[model samples]
Target: MTLTFIQNIGGGFLIIMLLFSLIYFLLWVYCVIDVIRSNFKDQNMKLIWIVILLFAHIIGPLVYLVLGKNTKVGY
Candidate 1:
């Protein structure tokens, strides 16, 4: 059977979802803290990033990592 099929048969699906949710929460917290502590060229950008992190949830941290790191004071 396929992995998804196996997962759906018992508790595997729940475990997988929970693991992913935990990882996402951890990443979100880390990114939010990083944004708070890092110095940005425009001070307001810090608040903006935090708001984005709070609202965007899934993709905010990812986009920030790929695009926002350049804007930090010392990278």
Candidate 2:
């Protein structure tokens, strides 16, 4: 009985981890695509953000979303 319970818990943890990984992967892809489509004007800025997000993982994307520039208006 104890063994069965442990197996069930382990399986549940694995499933949750897998789901989190999938969600993270999708979010990362979306962020990269969105950054590419953004009107940042400067190609270097866009590239910088892309590299940051790609190398820095979750925090990188979040930082970009919060603080990155949006070049919709004329500058």
Candidate 3:
């Protein structure tokens, strides 16, 4: 009985992990695309942002969006 209960909990945890992974991947993609499409004052800035996003994983994108991106909504 205890074994079955433990298995059920493990299955649920696995499903949750998969879901989180999917979300993380999608967010990463969106951040990369945004950095590519965005206009910056310096021509090389976009390249730098892309490199950061690619190598730094989740934290990279979050930091860029929060600190680096321009607040103007039009672009």
List the global CA lDDT of all models.
0.89, 0.78, 0.79
Stretches off by above 4 angstroms in model 1 are 1-9
On residues 1-75, what C-alpha lDDT tens digit does candidate 3 reach at each position?
Answer: 988876778777988989999998888888888877777777787888888888898699788878666632344
Q: Which wins on TM-score, candidate 1 or candidate 3?
A: 1
**Candidate 2 lDDT, tens digit per residue, 1-75?**
988876778777989989999988887887888788887766678888889998999688677767675642253
Candidate that would win on TM-score: 1
Residue 29 lDDT in candidate 2: 83
Best by lDDT: 1
- In model 3, the runs with Cα more than 4 Å from the true position are 1-9, 71-75
Model 1's alpha-carbon lDDT is 0.89
Please give, for residues 1-75, the per-residue lDDT of candidate 1 as tens digits: 688786667687778988999999999989999998899988999999998998998799998999888888876
